[model samples]
Structure formats: structure tokens, C-alpha cells
Target: MAGTPIANSSTKCLPEGMPSIMGAIYPIEIMQDAKRLVVLAEFLSQTRRVHIGEKMPPADDTEPSYNGYSVARWDGDTLVIETSRVRPDVLFFNVPHSINMKITERLRRSSPTLLENKVMIEDPDYLSRPYSFTFQYKKTDYKIGEFVCENNQTKVDAEGKASLQLQPDTK
Candidate 1:
């Protein structure tokens, strides 16, 4: 397990050194059947970005690789997600989360169509603390559209490359 803190940012850019998988995307699909809710998202990569729905806006060129494979199941009203088999190429930009890194997310519906998600990131290779984050989503009635990144283009420079920006320990 790679030890690394999954950086939190309003932007979608992943940290440096973390390779984007082939099909990772946000606003994953949640299918509910009886007591079970299944969530699905593609694992995306720099070389191949998966088209799940409508093409999302291009992330910052300076951003690290984005996207990963994730699935979630509902436990009662709370959603529990387990993410694995992550690509080690860019792990959170440069922090280097291992491919064995495992992430768990807990989600709860704050409203009929709104869900709040709390994510926990764990890795043995790059993190000193377990990273956590929260995100919110609203349900939409629109159908999924074609999302493709083949035409999206950006220029990368040395400064744009993902890297671990560590702060000095205050202790």
C-alpha cells in the first residue's frame, strides 16, 4: 500500500506522479435496487480518457492526472464506497500513492436528490496522515451524454508536471 495523502482541491487535477487511468469520471451513476445502491465510474488515464457522459470541461493543463476506478454500495441510508486497482502512474500528482492504495467513501442523502459524500484515502507508500474530503452532488433528470477527450488538447511543461509539495513539519 502506497502511503500518500490524497490532496484536496476544488479543482479536478490530481497530484503529481499519479497517472490518470483510462476512464475515471465524476458524477458517477448510482443505481438503486431494493436496499442496494450501486455506483459506477470509469478509470481514466492521460493516454486514454473514457467518455462516460457529456464531455466535461478540460481540467487545468497544470493539473496532475485525473480519474480512477470507483464503486459504492449503500449500507442502510449511508453509502460505502471501495476504490482499488488504481493506476500508480501519477498517484495524487507526486505524492505517489501505490497501486494498492484503497479508498473508502461514506455517503448520505441530505435531501431527496442531494447526497453528501465523505471520502477517506489510505496508502502505505506516501501518506503520513489519512486524507479525508467531502463532496456534494444533486440528482439530475438529464440522460447521460457522450463524453470524449480525444479532441481536448493541452500543453505540458516541466513546471506543469505533478509533484508533491510538502510542508515542513512544525513539530
Candidate 2:
């Protein structure tokens, strides 16, 4: 299946942590200050913190991770962000990224109600060349709500069947 994780007994529909590419696909709320910019996803509740500029140095290669280290700079109306030192813990679809994975993104407001994100991901380990894509979001009056994953809350019964606990309605 194209763009889908490979089907395997050990493969999960989604990994424990947010995949690096999700930053561009999901609905994100961006909060910025003098020092850093925080992008918070409404779905998985993932948060990415990016340094304002080259002021913050990239993380040591020994500290590889999913999101890695992100640094951003403002180019007129566009915010250019570069991330590197990523680990292979998460996959881009079914393809795994190497520690050398690097991502560059351009975020800009297309309109008063529209946000656009152009992203490019590179990883020689799993990709023939860099892949680029763009994702956009239209402003909505909708509010973000709580999203809790029950994957870790699964329990096994005496019969050896796993089940999730259905939370009681608070309303």
C-alpha cells in the first residue's frame, strides 16, 4: 500500500510518539514568543518547540529523536524551519528514516483564515531523494477538545482477551 506502513505482526497503526511529518498534516495551534515558537496539535496533543533563529544551536548528534531539533527564522512573511538529528524510532508511512533525516519547512499565512505549510523531508536511508508536500488549514471557530489514547490502557481478561476501558460520560 502506497504511503501506508508496511503490514507486519509487530507494526502498529501509529507509533507511541508523534511522527515528524505530522506537524504539517494536523491542525496545529501556533504560539510564539521572543525566544521560541510552540506548535501544538489538537489530535494527538503533540507539541513541537522551535527556537526562534540560529541563536539556538542544533542538538548533539548523540541526542537523536523523533522531532529532533528545530530552528526557525523569519523570511519576510514566511517562517523557515530546519530540523535534524532525527532518530529512526518512527517511520514516514511504512518507510523508516535514518539518523541522518532532515526536514525543512516553510510556514506562512496564505490568507487571514488560511495557513499553509510546505515541507520537505530527506533521508537517504529509506528514500531515493527528498520528498516535498504541502498541507493547508482554514481557520475555524471550532475549539480543541481533550483527546486521550487508550492504547496503553488496554487490559487482558482472565480469558486472555484484551479490552479497553470505556470512560464514563462527564456531561
How do all models score by TM-score? Answer: 0.52, 0.71
Maximum-lDDT candidate = 2
What TM-score number comes out for model 1?
Answer: 0.52
Off by over 4 Å in 2: 1-26, 55-62, 152-171
Q: Candidates' lDDT values, in order?
A: 0.48, 0.66
Best candidate, TM-score-wise?
A: 2
Overall local distance difference test of candidate 1: 0.48
lDDT (Cα, 0-100) at 4 in candidate 1: 34
**RMSD after Cα superposition, model 2:** 6.2
* lDDT of candidate 2 over 98-131, digit per residue (tens): 7778788888999999888888988787789889
User: For model 1, what is the error of residue 86's alpha carbon versus the real structure, in angstroms, after optimal superposition?
Assistant: 0.9
Least well predicted 10-residue stretch by lDDT in candidate 1 = 15-24
Quote the lDDT for 54 in model 1: 25
